[model samples]
Target: MCGIVGAVAQRNITPILIEGLLRLEYRGYDSAGVAVLAEGNGIQRVRAVGKVIELQNALQATPATGHLGIAHTRWATHGKPAEHNAHPHMSGKLAIVHNGIIENHSPLRKKLIELGYQFTSETDTEVVAHLIAHYYSESHDLLDAFRTALGELHGAYALALMHEDQPETLYCARMGSPLVIGQGSDEHYIGSDPLALLQVTDRFRYLEEGDHARLTINTCEIWDRDNLSVDRPLTRYEHAAHSLEKGEYRHYMLKEIFEQPQAIRDTLAGIVGDDHVLTAILGPDAETRLVDIANIHIVACGTSYHAGLVARYWIEDQAGIPCTVEVASEYRYRTVVVPDNTLLITISQSGETADTLAALRFAKDQGYLATLAICNVAGSSLVREADWRLLTHAGPEIGVASTKAFTTQLVALLWLTTALAQVRGKPADQIAANVKALKDLPAIIEQALTLEPRITTLAERFANKHHALFLGRGTHYPIAMEGALKLKEISYIHAEAYAAGELKHGPLALVDEDMPVVSVAPSDALLEKLKSNLEEVRARGGQLITFACETIDQTNDSNHEIINLPFVEGCISPILYTIPLQLLSYHVALVKGTDVDKPRNLAKSVTVE
Candidate 1:
């Protein structure tokens, strides 16, 4: 995903746009560009490969000024990262900056070529600009021309356009990617990220699918697909004001990690109380039906999948239901035998994730008895499709790494387990005690974040390792997989996760003293079995970093170090155990001097297939 922003301001817009680009750079860093409509002049454009600083320096070399403008920090899906491929792609009269892929770009390019439009760069975005220019020649107005061209386009996109013919206004539209309109004094802005508008304004309207906005210096008009003008409500963003400040922390990642305490407290407030956990959606037969189900099929993408993995153990042990977890993409392609009375649970931070949403639709089509979704967004598509829903009060998770959302999902899933146990007629004392544990999770998580120093130190040991393995069993297996994914994505480390029991099958052959193995060996029933597995690694001379519930006194046999974790009940251990692993991967990436937040070639949302 790339970042796109546009501003029509009473004052000079270059600085505002540039500042906005800086905030949105986490979305992409391949290249940066800006196009502004100059007074009594045509569109002035500047672009360069690399970060915003490079574009800033390029702009300094040859400056462009205008009050109405659009800018993009590109992630380069369609072409290489070069000046020619950089965004703010321009035609004779139109300039366009786009995010998301145009899947039919080849056919669109061919049609435009046949229509006598010359293309300058190898980009799907360039095709859009040319298409607009082609139509503007006929319509004589930018907005009407834009509507005509967009009618032919396909795939996910959030586009912002500035035209020489319509220099006073910037037009924006969204299909799947995030776009927000910020209201300002004598100005109006559209940005892919809310952080771009944080300094300029607090009030913002989140543009929905098929919505378009025309922004002028003093006015903004939003329009739907049918050409009817509409007004979307604006909400005051909570993090808008405090966003720019590093405040009491050194980096946003660390600040967000520490903010988990407050995040948990905020998420748990009102949702759980008086020794009873609650879901945003609850029914009398809901818990009983879920527990009575023959099987569960949990589907999600990225960090949400990790949460599902944790839930698998809870559902299996506590609710006595068989559970299977799948990556939504693969799940969609596979021929799934939907067992009758199966509950298909789809989890997503943003319920609009292309693959996850498709998976939910597929599950419904196959006639699964009940489909439930755990998500953060209120009216997201998955919520509409599911028979039941649980909302994690994680607010908006702006960062791509997904800190707060993952924790809140864990809270919700753990609550689901307790509720299922209760409805299945579990003893009162057991249900009450488990509810008490769930209530105390926020405090326990706060205590966990204090392990920052320990995690940081552990990170140093593995920072230089080229290859690694994350091993776990049962609930911890998915956590191991998540940790490996994070390590590989952020640190550029070659890592794989495997169940500890499955290690000897093939993965163990790659292990040696030079390679590090991070083990998730919590104090569960399989702890002794996991201990013997760790011994196998030691016998093979593999360096070890073990995360366990208790301290290991015998640390001499190829064991590197042990990070003690909070000992909780087996049902809820995955939630608490995940904290250290997340911190460990985060710190390792930090120590390796990698871009922990944006990680190369990764976007916060997968809007396009």
Candidate 2:
């Protein structure tokens, strides 16, 4: 994800702009830049190839001061992570910062080159500056030029622009990307995330799709999608800004991992009971929609997709409905066949994930009974667009690898499973058992975290290992995939996960004394099959580490190490098994000396395709 922040204020706003960029550093970026309309310096800019701190250092060396400015943390979508390719891409007297892909930039750049516009950087964002500036030259009105330029754009973007002539105003626009306005005393700000502006102002207004605005010290005029002036409702953000800090933890990833128990407890606080899950947790009319009998379709990306995969098992086994999960990017690009009463569900942590949002938009036209958004951000575009929503109350997940968020999403999915089970005439005894397990989830996860010291010792063995295999059966298969993903993401280790049954088919050949294999052996019906698979690995001299049910008779030998998990049944087992896997990755990444919070080449929120 890319970060964008802009401000027009009464005092020199350089401090405000840089502070916003500092807060947005967690989104992950390889380059940073800022542009300010200096008194006589006509849109001065400072750029750096790596880290927002480098940009801050350069800004201190060569001060770029103005009452108005724009700053960005670029994640390298259209160009390399070079100073020239950093954001605040300028053309003539105009400078702009952008966050999303420009699909038509190639053709637009060609047209501008033929029109005598010289390109200085290999960025699609620069093409946008030239396009806007070219229009500005003719219209002489910034908004008019912006309006004309917006007509030709063919992709997602959240833009902040400043022209030399518009010294007192900042131009902003949002299309398919997230942008919010921060209101303050005689000053206004725009940030891609509300957290970025918390230091200056908590009062914010989320820009709707196709919303464009011109901001000055005392005014923020927003145009609706229909080009008519409108007022978006204001939100006074109350979530603690201090939650972003790591506190006593060595890394944010560790802090988030330890926070999982509380996160799961919060997620199940009101929705679960002693014996059954409240169906109304989906919505007041949830059962009204659930009564319609058919299968379900789940769409998501990355970690969210793994949550969907786990949900397929619960929804199918408990609710007796066919659940199909698809990656949102691929799902959006193809023709989908929706069966009757097929409810479309999209999972996202940010809820601003570009492809997931696009897929949700596409699913709307597919004749689904209703749309449900399993999201973290209550105000995100996905929640607003969906017919129903179930928030994964995992709080703020600053880590790029996603620890608490993934588990909380599973908790939310369990809630959905019980709701569907009740309405679909599933066994009352089974529904009660599922809910009873969920109620004990917080304590189970807390016990699971106790294995951290043991996992830390086990992770040391993996620090030097280059390749590993993960094996699981049934719902735990997705948990194994998630474990593999977490390892690859933060540890930079090459890991592959497979269904335990698929061992003889291919993955077993790569196993040897040097190859470390991680397995999730829950005491489900597939335990016998998983045991046979583990025997295959042991016979091949594969180094083995397993998170197992305590009931499984196991002894740690030279090749096998077992970390016992608190036993649980039904839908809650996968959620419990996920805890040890998370700690394993965290400690492995710790041993590998990688940036656990913001891993290389990854962002916490994937706001762009």
The best candidate in terms of TM-score: 2
Give lDDT tens digits, candidate 1, residues 1-609.
367888998788899899999976544256899988889778888999988999999999989888989999975555667899998998887788987656568899999999998887888889998988888888787788889988887766789988776778889998746689999988899988777878799889988778988888788889987878898998998763246455666555566666666555544443343454432224334545655667789999999998898888887777677889899999999899988888889999888999999999988788788988888775578876787767675655655787778878888888777777766767777777777787667677777788888788878887668999999998889888888887887788899999999988998899898899998877877888888998888889888988888644444343667777777766667777778877887899888998777788888877777
Q: Estimated TM-score per prediction?
A: 0.59, 0.62
lDDT for each candidate structure = 0.79, 0.86
**TM-score for candidate 2:** 0.62
Alpha carbon deviation, residue 400, candidate 1 (Å): 1.8
Displacement of residue 518 (Cα, Å) in model 1 is 0.6
Model 1 clash tally?
Answer: 0
Q: Which stretches of candidate 2 lie over 4 Å from their true place?
A: 1-242
Evaluate candidate 1 by giving its C-alpha RMSD to the native, one decimal: 16.9
Model 1 ranges off by over 4 Å: 1-246, 283-294, 551-559
Instruction: State how far residue 165 of model 1 sits from its true place (Å).
Output: 62
| Per-prediction tally of clashes | 0, 0
